[model samples]
Target: MSVHIAAQIKRVGRTLTANRAFLECITGVWLLTAATHHYIMAPASVLSQVATDLHITSGVAVWLVSAVPASWAVTNFALGVWIDRLGDYRMIALGVGTVILTGVWSWWAARQGVFSSLLGSRLVAGVAVGVIWTASVNLIGGAVSDINRATAIGVFITSAPAGFALGQLSTPVIASWIGWPASFLVMSGAAGLAFALITDSVRHLAIDPTTNTASMRANFTAVLQHRAVWYGCAMAFAAYSYYLFMNSWMPTYLGQRFALSAALSGGLAAVFPAMGVLSRVGSGLISDRLLGQRRVPVLQAAFLISLPLIVLIAWTRWLALIVTALIVAGFVIQLTFGVVYSYVREVVEADITGTALAFLTTAGISGAFSAPVITGALIEWTGAYLPAFTYAAVLTAIGLLLSWVAPESPHSMN
Candidate 1:
């Protein structure tokens, strides 16, 4: 047993700090990942705090939760290709710098107790998210070899859900002890720490080699014409829509529906992202090892399995059943995130990899927040969670139909 434990420790230690560059990249990604999530989840984690402090309903409070990803989507569309083409060290450094400045603003704005100010701070923090997130994903994807693509993408993305889980788990307790705004302060420190450690590491990353130099319009138009690219974009939109809906609204939903406290509600909601962390790695491994020639099967199964679980959440009154349903839903819903990234990389031209990524992410992030905002307004109009769950079901169905027809990547078989 001791020998086994030692071997496990050695394996983990080797992977985590394999070299200075790897260390910096993973650590920076994890911290910034945590920072983005912590920023939005502060509101989600303390939905009651926003409601009381800002004089808003739970639905209105979620607009603050949705705002970061909305801005992130816009930034992805606006800057993804440009950053991919022209960015590297300076992009990463500036991204980190933006997060630090805006993270502090988020902390302060939330503390001041105004709705618009808090929403504005979250939006600005999202720009930082778009910058850092694009740089980090590009760095990891470009650095690794094609053979290991799924594993690298999967492992790297685990950081986001991990950060989200960390925020969800800790923020409620921190908010309870130190006040809600303090969570943002702690998360800001995390982003600051990442900037300090990561800037130098990014300076050394390998540039993506490319032969295509077409005009932006031609590059985008080319990829857009491919069926696989559309599949990736469509999946991104559906997956992110369901993810953000739950993340932005579930804490408040649990609290209001179950009559639980903020801390407890956050803890319960934390189960979702926590499951996501492990499921992402598992999905990647499945793509890499079990289904090396395909990703659509994994992607399709994820959508099909998630439908009932989502409905269960909206319909069930029993806490144990709801939690169980959420855990399963979380696992199934997250599989596509890691698998499709590798899949997207396989299908798109290397020159516009970032452009394609921007396309996918914008489609995804926009899908993530757009309907939820309307869902918020819908809840105002109808005063029930059924409409949101019904919407999630339809989106998942659409994802399934798309995945069924998704073209298999040639690189995956090669």
Candidate 2:
């Protein structure tokens, strides 16, 4: 571990200190992405309250939870070229700006008890999120050198789990004091701060304002034809499926099985995503240092380790034991999340990173959007959680197989 840490420090060199522009670009992009996640998840904790207040069935209210990702899945693909044309900084601004706008709109809609208005706001926010997600990564990939890119991106991706955990833990607590609407307001305020950070920092970054239709067409064709990109997409789909499965259902599962309070179940489930804060960066450090920047091996190991852990999470009845499994599974399952982002970019040329990542983001978030819905449907049909979990385990097994056979990034494999 000490040797790995030293290697990381040596690779990073003066990037952290002497390169002030890179530091600011990464910091702003990280905060911008984190704020988008916070906006995406702010309502998750209060969905029950939303259902009760709006006089809607729990079934209809669940859309409030899934709506953002569902919309994100579709728009992420549609916005691929637009992301390139607008350049990273403009796209980032547009995305963060939209989140701020929609956050306020959702808050107002909730205050008025209009379910459609609130849901509409979320769908719009999802579009913005898709924009931020792709552009932020493009900015990171473009800003850092290939040698240090994985480490930098790993650090950037930590914002996701951090923001997710923050929204899950903070929203309910904030609602308890004032009201659920206040949660959206707080999220919007956070976005406002992110906007300030980004606007102040990213002025020095390069802008790729490619407006030629022919160039866009060629880039799209190049990304679509790459075989390794598809493997990376497959890994993304599986990882995201497992991620959302746990995020969406674990709290309710704990509540149903153990009779834990909503707060307690949520707090426990929060442990799952919370683990990503450390594991994402750790995976990056290990891949960059210990594995000589090899991403496929880390991905293969994560999926292989996750197979039994998923089964253990599904069947275990002991609270203490399940919590232990959750901790380990959380870290193990998400080991690929940060790595895949780096993998997809490294597999392709620098010019088309945005287009390549669009395919990856689309596939990944599609899994995220579909997982809970599919699992919920299975549980409804079978009258049990076992089948749903089995489905997730099968997906992870497929991911492991894909990682086993997938080609490694030529540049990254020393």
Tens-place lDDT per residue, model 1, 216-327, is 7777787787778889999988988888788767888999998999778877887876787888888888877888747888898999898778877888899999888888
Global lDDT scores for all candidate models: 0.77, 0.83
TM-score of 1: 0.84
Off by over 4 Å in 1: 1-20, 50-62, 110-115, 172-179, 203-205, 209-215, 248-266, 311-319, 378-380
The lDDT leader among the candidates is: 2
How many Å off is the CA of 92 in candidate 1?
2.0
Q: Each model's TM-score? A: 0.84, 0.91
Cα displacement (angstroms), candidate 1, residue 207, comes to: 3.5
